[model samples]
Target chain A: MTSHPPAGTPSGIVLEHVTKRFGRTEVLTDISAVLPPGRIYGLLGANGVGKTTLMSLVCNHTFRSGGTVLIDGEDPAENPVVLGRTCFIREDQPYNDAFKVRDVLSAVSWFYPDWDAALAERLADRFHLPHRTTCKKLSRGQRSALAIVISLASRAAYTFLDEPYLGLDPSARGIFYDELLLAYSEHPRTIVMSTHLIDEAAGLLEEVLVLHEGRIVLRADADEARTSAFVARGLDSAVTALVGHREVLSERRLGSILSVTVRGARTADDESRARAANIALEAASLQELVAAIGIGGIGGVDTESFTTQRTSR
Target chain B: MTYARRSLRLYLANRSYVTLIPGGILVIMLAMSLVIGVAIGMATEFPLSAQIQEGMRENNGGAVYSIPGFLISLGALAVNRNFAMALAFGSTRRHFWLGTLMGFGLTSGATAASAVVLLALEKATNHWFFGVYAFDVAALGKGDYVLTFASVFVLAVLSLALGALFGTAYRAFGTKGALLTGLAAAVLVVAVTLLSASNKEIVGSWLGALGVWAAVVVAAIAAAISIAGSYAANRLARL
Candidate 1:
């Protein structure tokens, strides 16, 4: 039922020096990345770091201020063939206030050629979403559930989920994850999800793209990202002396002890020295790496001075 | 379905608002007009038939205006509420615009056709058997079915286009922007009216010479302009 056939050789999303600006402020600057098809990519970033903006630009929901965005080697702007294969649901996705939950689902079903009505019904029941309630009257959690229903059921070739778990509880989030996995396993589409709950969603992500100040500071495989940096914890003097001017991503002090996240894997020699100095060296989690990149400034920013000032404080 | 057809479905999703409500309003207005006409006939001193005919000839019905008015509000709501949803769901701007135009055409055409049918019925029944004059009002082409259909159709299109323009203004800008646009439209209308009044002799002669079709042509042109403006506004709108 798709209006256009799937690309014979899908290049996926190829963004080259994409930029977005709001008035005088640049939201996304020189963002370039190639998201190949059929993999789940995690768009990780701190708030206002352009995670949502980047997704919006790629979806052509908002026009890019500059640069070229190609989904499946085609400009998506006003292209029905391209857009039909894409779906990007915002965190606060607006629905017609007058539409009931069922109405929203039914209306969206018509747009997506691969819309799974049976799955939509199952998800609604599992989420306990009141079918007859108007969208405006639905609670935040209910609204999020409705969004999830739309996103997964759409079966779009490229789907963007921006903070799709805004108000779901732990159990509900578990259901969402299970349903997402099941859907992905069955349909195998490209899913780019942006979330602040990094560790919770870390398992689902195959690749990670960390955005900092409208730029992608870190892009790596989920497994590679975990080992991109290491956290060393010990007394400030011992940790600093052993570290010896290495790149520090972030550092925090609790009275006398210092726990610093430094870029690059822990060397064998460094590990031995850390053991002798009572400094515990551990791999940095995806969440910590993103936080450090956001807080300590990556992308050639002065992390040395930032680390020094924070350590001294 | 094609994107345009999908968008049309989106616009027509709420059948109650698009079709039922407007039809219901028209029916209610017609009923009210009938009641008013009957009461006036009973109060007259002349014979009922003559008085009813004389009344019908003298007074034009305002009921039909509700159809276009309802359509105008519906058009505004469609843009205000559905545009973002449409984009999020993967509808291209071009498809949305095309589908919206189709929806507008269908709605207006259906309403105009209904009005023409009612006009025919009124004439066939001699204005509801007693010249009650519900659909036979002077503003609705004075029982001329073709003119009445054309006039109502044009008015409906104009109303929908105006509403869509306002909605687009609201989306591209915020509340203040929409309000300013509305004020600007009001000012323009007032200015045109004032100018026309000042040069009534010249303007009147031009209008009189052009006849009814000229008004329809002008309205159609205005609707086209508004549709274009809406497309531009939609492009500028974010989220």
Candidate 2:
């Protein structure tokens, strides 16, 4: 039972030459991109790849070591007007030990102008959050649920969720997906969510941004990303012949059976060629693309072909 | 202004701690004085010495106890996890810092007011009718109340500001740096205490010479620490 805001005030985020370094460790290096408004942008990446750091910089939760961040055309740092329209709920959000679940909801209501108490209550009930329970006493899943409730109920124009489903079970995750889409449909806003459950969350994303080793490797339409590449398997000669000159993201061989993940769209001609060569053509899932991209085996393929918008800015 | 309003609400939410802890301490001290005075009154009485009688007549207690209220406020402000969460929920660092300052300001004000009220009560009741003082220490009665309040208020504010500065340093520099900073502060405090103890006559003479103006010096210290604290919070704090 998801409720939406009466009116929308969406905001877009722009990062220009953003670089973040902690002490001597450079986390995000000169990464730049424009995340457009009123869409669900998935921030996909493996561990320690600066996905969380990038989100922190855009939300002004952490200061950027270099470059500039503009939220709705204004800097978010110390700017209350811009900050009021943004919410960044992280996986390990530290709530005061003394605060109860109800206290957190009450406090957040004051921070976001468009906050919906009714929606928060509904989400809390659905998530089985005990209003009287202190935040420190909550289970891991309950903590995640509380974070989700805050992110959705705040109704901020620019919402960033860094692994908002860390401890959520499949059923709770399903609720998150359902409620997310329902809320977005009724009150559209820009939402950037980072998650490791790629295939499960792929359907909810309008656009996908894949980060590998602190750099955005691919930024493409979610659907297109799913079909961006395909697996070719058959005899070694046939598979090799079919995958020639194309980027091979990954390759595996067993005896005479050869399989390779090629980077390109699946066309009728390619399908016919695979058929004639007695090869199997299987479309690569977004999960596989993420896995392949993270491991640095794009098969010498031009990433521009997969991404609708590149992050060379 | 909206952020200001947000911070105000945040400050208000934690109002109980600002009032209760100091108020409770004052009550407990008053009760202890009453119990001790009654037990002594029941004991066998001999001819008391002039100095002992004077001591009993002017005895004041718990004047310094209310200072911990600053640490209570600091515990809420410094090293507090809620500030980080508040930022994630959409508060700017400026808002959090301002809200904390407002909260500490109110805490100090309430503590000072409480001290004044207790002082008046002690004076009216002749030190709780048992020759004991719970708030008007050093026989500094109605005429000196304002100076006493100012001194207490300054110390309270300084403690709160130091807490904020320490918390910011901890967040910006991690646990090791925070520990080192804490150690440095502790060492500095210990060194000052030892120096003052070793030069008690000089320190006492100097303090006596300053008279009520000593509170003014403390006020300046408070102001400087608070300004530095706000700067640290605004520039160095991270979520």
**TM-scores, each model vs. reference:** 0.91, 0.87
Query: Ten-residue segment with the worst summed lDDT in candidate 1 chain B?
Result: B45-54
Task: Let me know the DockQ for model 2.
Answer: 0.75
State the DockQ of every prediction. Answer: 0.85, 0.75
lDDT tens per residue, model 2, B1-239: 65756766766676677656665566776677666656665672333334543565466435555465556355436446667776887787777777767767777777677778877887787666656545665533323688667766665677667766667766766677567767876786798789989999998888789876665575556557555754564567676
Total backbone clashes of model 2?
2
Predicted candidate 1 versus true structure: per-residue lDDT over B163-206, tens digit per residue: 88888888889788789878987887798889999999998888
Instruction: State the lDDT of candidate 2 residue by residue for A1-313, as single tens digits.
Output: 1122222333377777789888899888767677779999999988888888998888888889998888777778888878888888888888877789999899999888789899899999999899999999999999999999999998988888889888899999999999899888878999999999999999999999887766677888899888888888899998887777777776778999987777777779889999998999989988888887776522222233443232110
Model 1 spans > 4 angstroms off: A1-8, A299-313, B45-52, B187-206, B209-214
Could you report the Cα RMSD, in angstroms, for every candidate shown? 4.2, 5.5
Model 1 CAPRI quality: high
- Candidate 1 has an lDDT of 0.83
TM-score, candidate 2, is 0.87
Candidate 1: residue pairs that collide: none
